[model samples]
Target: MTTPANRWRDTPDRYGLISRLLHWLTAAQVILLFGVLLAWKGFGEHPVTLLLARIGPHGSLGAMLLVTTLLRAIWAYRQRHHRPPRPPGVGGLLARSVHLAFYTLLILIPALAILRQYGRGGHLIFYGMELLPEAEREIAWMMAPADLLHSPLAWLLLALIAGHVAMALAHRLWLKDGILARMLGSPQATRDT
Candidate 1:
């Protein structure tokens, strides 16, 4: 009874609508964030980055991503026992490790950024609304982890995602498995077992 309209919950055989939405939505946001960063680095204050800055700053995007990431994590926990079975082997272990890393970085990067923002006496503002008020003075200790890890960790996350996509492609093309289809296609399109 997993019709397209009613696939909001996950099944043991495939992902449901909510998971797919969160997955793709988060992917899009991360891609945009990377694009903005790349543009900022290559063309420091180019019109495109300036225009995007006007619409929403990178901080706001990170906050939004954090929210989505939390929701995804919660959903994943609730569905932990309901997800598809992994193929038992080293590949499975690697997949699980990558997923754990993804979840960790998704939560950690923004968290570190928020901490750094606070330590620097800057408010954590989202869409121009203040979430965390600025501290009266800079706290070097609060800001150190972000200073050392944020950029590097973000790049590592991007690399992991690239590998994740490559594996999914491998599942679709080389393995002839329906792993990718579970996220991208209807129930009928995926292999049930």
Candidate 2:
């Protein structure tokens, strides 16, 4: 019953409009964050990097990402019983595992970073909104997890994303399945008959 115009809700064969938007929006944010991090690491604080950092720092963006991931998780859970069936056998299991990891890291990485931010005894102002008030002193316990895991976990997330993309492309181009089209192509074009 899902037509092109009514693609706002998910069908068994394809993701709905809202889900697609959220997925792409999250992807864009992740790419932007990666770019900023790479620039900061490579250039070591040039004026341009500083300006970019001030304009779109990791903490604020991470907060945004955290919110997006939470909303996406809720949406996915609500639609869980309505979506297309996973492929059977090992492919299905692998797909499920990758999705689980992605969701876990998406929520945890920024959460840990945010904890670390507040633990450093500094106020966090995200796009002019005050998220955390300044602390009196650095809290070692609060900061430790992020200091140890945030960057490494983020890199792992990036690797998973790479694999995800590769698998999507393989599904579309090599396997000749419509997996990528379910998310990216016209819903009508990929609709189950």
The candidate that wins on TM-score is: 1
Model 2 / residue 112 / CA error / Å: 0.1
Q: What is the TM-score of each candidate against the true structure?
A: 0.93, 0.91
C-alpha lDDT score of every prediction, in listed order? 0.86, 0.86
Candidate 2 Cα errors over 4 Å, as ranges: 3-6, 185-193
TM-score, candidate 1, is 0.93
Across residues 22-123, which tens digit of lDDT does each residue of candidate 1 receive?
999899889878888887888899898898666658899899899999999999999888776666899889888889999899999999999999999999
lDDT of 2 by residue, 1-193 (tens): 6576758767777788888988998998899889889889999879978887877788888999999999999999988886766789999999999998999999999999889988999888788889889999999999999999999999999999999999987887788767777787345345322
The clash tally of candidate 1 reads 0
